[model samples]
Target: MQPNQFNVDAANKLKIVSLVSVGKHPQSGRMRRADQDSRAVELGLKLTGDNHSGESLVVLHAGDPGEPNLRSYAGMGLKSVRVLQLDPAADAILPLGQHLQQCGADIVLTGVRAESGESSGMVPYQLAEKLGWPIVPRVADIVSVKGGVAEVLQALPRGQRRSVMVKLPFIASVDSAAPEARQSAFGPASRALMDIEVVSASVDDVRQAWEEAAARKRPKRLKVVKAKTAAERFKAATAKSQGDGGKVMKNESAAEQAQAIFDLLKEEGVLR
Candidate 1:
């Protein structure tokens, strides 16, 4: 009944593919295995665990096969990743959809958005359109697949969730709410083979006309404080908002000023 455990017949019969991309570290901009894509790979591995062969879950990527980060997904126990070799400027939806049709894939998993490049988060949707498969957006987890129907959890606003049943041959975009991926083992990553195949592709004319520029870092959004416990809820409901008054600590000692700033942070729950 657990997410990691599945009916052997259902798990073995269904074909699942996870599409991954090169991820960029938020601060460093270093390339790595994408976060949500890795979670999709993790879920794919979980589905294959009951069978023990890991052959049912196929990891696919449409880009350079030699990309070092692609092996990171293989480190999570995937034997190999099927890479569709194409020009970086080419749109992947056509080839990806073609491959899925050729492979007779029943379930397709993808990240909500790529960590690099245009990051429009439209690959899954576009692929679904091209393949004529239903798409479940922002999937938090794939609970089970039975009778050609897949029970899934969808991530919603404010930490809420929805359970939906999608028929077979569907696409689901993995959300950040999904389980965190396991650590990538270096040995497995080093040994994992990149199965690359050259495919026909066309450069996107629409994308070519767009202007490109460096990204500017934006200010971080304040974290929302959730009140779950009864006491916490009561505190949240009864607490009075601070006044519009500003305090000046011009005459305060160095330690007092530091303590005051720390206390302010604690009051704002930033320290916690």
Candidate 2:
């Protein structure tokens, strides 16, 4: 599906919202505009541009309104970004869902996952469930919208593509394979407004206990040996694992062999 190929009348009148989040640099650990979320905003821009309509699309954020990085998102030719002010530890789902449900928007776009925090990619799914709207996940682009139905192109594994038709008032998670976002300009970004709204904060008890830290790879689990009979069990237990490039101890004593196995297990962190 190519860009700018949607119905002009529908595009002009279409109410769209794109959800954005603060992104983190993988190496430097600095905040920036999220990648997939930026593409979502780009998609929304194209949706309105199809009809040469301006300001028909609304950009939204659920966290801090004062974050300097948010202006980068506004730099994408957006007039302002509507923000739902909440405590850092509060959950965004409740307020976001409530706002979206009452906003009467035809389409809601978001990234498949955030670059910061948990990055579980559950926000779109949870928002869809909250509003009782069907979601089209990993969508590369929306081909067209007509007759209250949207034809969307979904990104599949191995560079495959699939087309799905979803009704209006649906949620879509933009894929990384979607069109790259436009470069942000400093002039427009500086002049754009951060429209903050007053909202009651709902603390997220679950996230309150979260401790962010670096990740570590886990040890590969050893395959379990199964046997039906006692003789089979003994044979299986004593049998050497079938793999090339492995150390083999054929003439070693029982105690020495047991010690070697114990050391290997300890090195692998299989034993506490």
Candidate 3:
């Protein structure tokens, strides 16, 4: 179904809050505008224009207001953005929850994870816990918003999608499959000013000090064998790896070659 066909209440104006952050460039290893977070902002803008007419979209940041990455979002057509100035070492969950409560937004949106620094993709779940609201993760699109509820298209593995309806006052983490964000306008971005809100929040003492190292290529995954019983699992685990020693027929009779192929097929369990 098309995204616009969902039931939405035109009478009620929605207060949408989107959380954004700076991401790390995969190749350059430099700080840049986050793709997923920017997509969330784009979704917020689309929802505001398509359904909640006349209501302004709110963009929130939990880091430095002067960061170049944060400034880039202004060009995406958001009139203004609010930045919460917190210590680099502080945990963003508590302060962000307080800010959301103060804003009293009906819907909150964010990315699956930050691209830099401890990319644990846990902010949405943490924020939901703090706000006592339900979280819908990996949302592809907002199908419709009406009657204080939102119907969203959720992305799934292997090019699949599922539609879910969640009540308002919920958190949604936008997936990369959502609509791409528009290019940043230089004129607007240069003139944009962030409303910096200084927030004093305690840093989590449980976090351990860590050192950074150059990222290495990920190791290849091992093939898993599905087994239902203990004996089957043991057999699968102890099975010998296939070796490159299959027989090759070069000068055999036609019937013999065919029989050999059949035997090989039977050995591989390809034929009963």
Which candidate comes out best when scored by lDDT? 2
**Candidate 1 vs 3: which has more lDDT:** 1
What order do candidates take by TM-score, descending?
A: 2, 1, 3
The segments of candidate 3 whose C-alpha lies over 4 angstroms from its true place after superposition are: 4-12, 50-55, 218-272
Cα deviation at 172, candidate 2, in Å, is 0.1
lDDT tens digits by residue: candidate 3, 84-118: 99988888889999999999988899999999878
How far in Å is the alpha carbon of 49 misplaced in model 1?
2.3
Better candidate number, 2 or 3, judged by TM-score: 2
Measured with C-alpha atoms, the lDDT of residue 31 in candidate 2 is 89
Estimate the lDDT of model 3. Answer: 0.83
lDDT of each: 0.85, 0.87, 0.83
Q: How close to the true structure is residue 176 of candidate 2, measured as C-alpha lDDT?
A: 94
Clash-forming residue pairs, model 1: none
Q: Which one wins on TM-score?
A: 2
Estimated TM-score for each candidate: 0.78, 0.79, 0.76
Deviation in Å, model 3, residue 252 alpha carbon = 58
Off by over 4 Å in 2: 50-54, 217-272
